[model samples]
Target: MHELGIMTGVMESVETAARDAGATRVLEVRLTVGEMTEAIPDALEFAFEALSEQNELFDGAKLLITMVKPHSCCLACGAEFDHDRFHMFCPQCDSFALELLAGRELHIDSIEVDLPDD
Candidate 1:
């Protein structure tokens, strides 16, 4: 599964961000995953739980995922339609030059952290 690699990237990014922010511990990480990404949330969680070992920032952190649906707009006909992972073609006019309006995104929405005492 590519989830492991995705998780590693996420962890590394958040870890660096947390450290830079002077956070002693990371409490939670929120992510917005696109529907077209076809990522298994449970499997990703499992990988995250397994991979985050002895990481002071992520040892007991929580992972939250929000799924987004794929949307597309036809460049030829200027029609908008819902895009599916299995089919990348435009539904309205069967155009191959459809522009993706949504989905296929994997990024961090936000993070919760415990700041050190001042």
Candidate 2:
């Protein structure tokens, strides 16, 4: 799945940042994934496990994912609500005019690394 590709990119970035910070090992990675992105959590976890095994820096690293529900604001009634990807209409006014306030986000919130003792 595309999770592999996604994890590959994430690992590359984490590696670079960890190295730049003089980290001896990566301890954890925290990610925020939106439901609208359609990225499967199980698949993402599997990908992370597979990729991490290939890198020494990621050994025993933990992957923490925060799932974000799709949130939107209605342009018609100024109503804000949470909804699934399929139903995007505003509940208050039943209007299709909506602006997404959150979700569709794929971001690395933070990384925990073991830095060299200097």
- Per residue, candidate 2 scores C-alpha lDDT tens digits across 48-72 of 9999899999999999999999999
Where does model 2 exceed 4 Å of error? none
Q: State the local distance difference test value for candidate 2.
A: 0.94
lDDT (C-alpha) at residue 75 in model 1: 92
lDDT over C-alpha atoms for residue 7 of model 1? 90
lDDT (Cα, tens digit) per residue for candidate 1, span 1-118: 9888889889999999999999998999999999877888997898889877758678799999998888888899998888677787877678789788899889999999999899
Judged by whole-model lDDT over C-alpha atoms, candidate 1 comes out at 0.87
Maximum-lDDT candidate: 2
